[model samples]
Target: MPPGSPSHPALTPRRSPLLTLVAALVIVEALILVGAAVYLLHGLLVEDAAAPIAAIAMVVMALIFAVGVGFCGWGLLHRATWARSPVVVWQLLELAAGIPAFSGGSPWVGVVLVVPAVVVLVGLFVPSVSAQVSR
Candidate 1:
């Protein structure tokens, strides 16, 4: 197949492996956030009236983040250039959060948080992924 031809992998604007990985990570993160939001909302409804405002606030934050991340992931899968910046910002935030979590009592939580952020950041910055997104 010729370059830029429909069947030519190099010319096709397809999701590079790295981009796919980043998108998958973002989607997974969104799902987790959504799950947390659901759990928080459920607790708010089922539990006593203590700290209802805090629980409501957390639920709202989680839902908002879940939607944002989910939208970014969808854009990434579609190769939308605008998606890159937000994802990068999110990864940086995640890294910062992970660093603190790492020092806390739960090392496993830190590892879980840090590893995916690092992977997604590296993947997003890779030459192939960048080029694909730039197209």
Candidate 2:
């Protein structure tokens, strides 16, 4: 709203929900990594290939999450509008993945994963945040 500052012509978009979603997902994944490490210890071990594969997967996932969160947050804060869907899909997929495991495992897993998952999904659907994505 500054005078003579060359307005964007379009209204500034808001994507904080998406950015927040990414942060929550990152936290959930950190917990997952800890849980997996616990399982890998104390004779709850998986097979040979499984250990290496899990390690690689964790490393890659951490990198992916870092980049995705950075990009989504930057886009959201700057009103870039185009960063919404990828973040949405990413979080949804992680949520979906936690479901079956939750049913088979302890209750806390689902509780941890679902809360933020729902928040992020629902938050993105709201009028203000939804408007950013629609663009």
TM-score for every candidate vs. truth? 0.84, 0.61
Clashing pairs in 1: none
All models, RMSD in angstroms: 3.3, 5.4
Question: Lowest lDDT 10-mer window, candidate 1?
Answer: 6-15
- Highest lDDT scorer: 1
Which regions of candidate 1 fall more than 4 Å away from where they truly are?
A: 1-11
Computed on alpha carbons, the lDDT of every model, listed in order, comes to 0.87, 0.60
Off by over 4 Å in 2: 5-50
Q: Give the TM-score (vs. native) of candidate 1.
A: 0.84
Error of 2 at 98 (Å): 2.0
Instruction: Give per-residue CA lDDT, model 1, range 1-135, as digits (tens).
Output: 777677678866556878888899999989988998999998999978589999999999999999999999999898889998998999898888888886788788788778988998999889988886775
Query: In model 2, what is the error at residue 117, expressed in angstroms?
Result: 1.3
Model 2 RMSD vs true structure: 5.4
